[model samples]
Target: MELVKIYECLCDPTRLRLLHVLAQGPVCVCHFQAVLGEPQVKISKHLAYLRARGLVGSERQGNWVIYALPAKPSRELQANLACLQDCARGNPVFKRDLARLKQIEPSCAWVRAGEPQKAPGQCRGG
Candidate 1:
């Protein structure tokens, strides 16, 4: 809740990068794992860190936990997030993460015993 706490959370490069990716939209932890290419434990740990700082929130999407920014983050939190996103436009690391996310193969929203999973959003009827 405190601005100083938010700043401390932002001090980590991994956390900063996570914020940049999350700025796009809500994503499952698996997506972050694939994009960041970090182990599940590490990615989940960082996500938990962000969640505890009130910078991120999550919802259960079937079996997956989808992480996103809080619907009503503090004004300062919102502004800082906007700044992080804006500032990342030119950063190579953030750019790479974005590219990887775009390329991510969507998971199957529902497991059909025999059907292959389509890319994210591809589960919807076209």
Candidate 2:
């Protein structure tokens, strides 16, 4: 990827913040929403922008879509991201975003595949 494109992608504060969170690991839109405290559309818009720039990638997982850093990051991308991570050490908002990401729970969207009635009833001593 061209350095100019990478620099443009990092120009936005929101995108920069997202990069910090995504650097941790792959996550769903719901996770990003909860952590960023932003509307789904807005978060999705940013994700789409990053995906378009080839910085992030996504995959279908059941009913959810997971987004993560590109599997094959260019040397420039890797170095810049690593530097962002290091630079974020002194940024309170970035630190909080990372902390929130760690504490956020995973979505239970997968359970809808089966009815709750399929669950076993209260166990009784045999």
Candidate 3:
């Protein structure tokens, strides 16, 4: 991905949070909703933005669509993502988002359903 495009995608806080959680593993939109405590539409809208910009990718799992970092991220994206993760370590909001992700992993419908036998960023709990 172009550096400018990647930076453009990173400009939004919501997008930053989404990318942060996604760095942990693939998650469904509902998981984002729960973790970020944002409405489904809002979450989907941000996810769509990332998806369109090539910062994120998605796949269908039964009725759920899982979002994750690109399988083969560009060098620029990889570097920036690594930097974002490192920086997020000291941020309270990012820390809380991760905590919430852990709590919801076990109950996520997509994982509970036994999907993603080979899913990227496989759901953690089930």
Candidate 4:
């Protein structure tokens, strides 16, 4: 993990939010939709970008893909993430996003394997 690569990924708001949510635990794509209120395309694009940079990781669970932080992050990533966590505390948007994530987490659709039946018009992988 090069420092430039980590910073580049962290520079984007969407990517940073994604990482913030992920710091707590793994999240399904649909849960991201519910929490972020962004179109799946946009979320997926940022997620793919982070994944490509090795800042995030994914695992396929049936039709859903769960995204999470890397199990063993580089020192740079760890330090930057800690900074992000601290900096986000003063941002209203980040605060709201974290609150929403907490609200949705208990009943998150993919809580059990093979449990999330797709709702109509739910975002599917591109």
Candidate number with greatest lDDT: 3
**RMSD (CA, angstroms), candidate 4:** 4.0
* lDDT for each candidate structure: 0.77, 0.76, 0.84, 0.81
**Most accurate candidate by TM-score:** 3
Whole-model alpha-carbon lDDT for candidate 1: 0.77
Backbone clash count, each prediction separately: 2, 0, 0, 0
What does the lDDT read for residue 93 in candidate 3?
Answer: 94
Worst 10 residues of 4 by lDDT: 117-126
Judged by whole-model lDDT over C-alpha atoms, candidate 4 comes out at 0.81
TM-score, each model? 0.80, 0.81, 0.85, 0.84
Off by over 4 Å in 2: 105-126
Expressed as tens digits, the lDDT of each residue in 16-125 for candidate 3 is 99999999878888788888888889999989999998889888876578888998998899999999999999899999999998887766645545465444443433
Q: How close to the true structure is residue 62 of candidate 3, measured as C-alpha lDDT?
A: 64
Q: Which ten residues in a row have the lowest lDDT in candidate 1?
A: 108-117
Tens digits of per-residue lDDT for model 2, 70-101 = 88899999999999999999898998888776
Q: Clashing residue pairs, candidate 3?
A: none
Tell me the alpha-carbon RMSD of every candidate.
6.0, 7.9, 4.8, 4.0
* lDDT for position 68 in model 1: 81
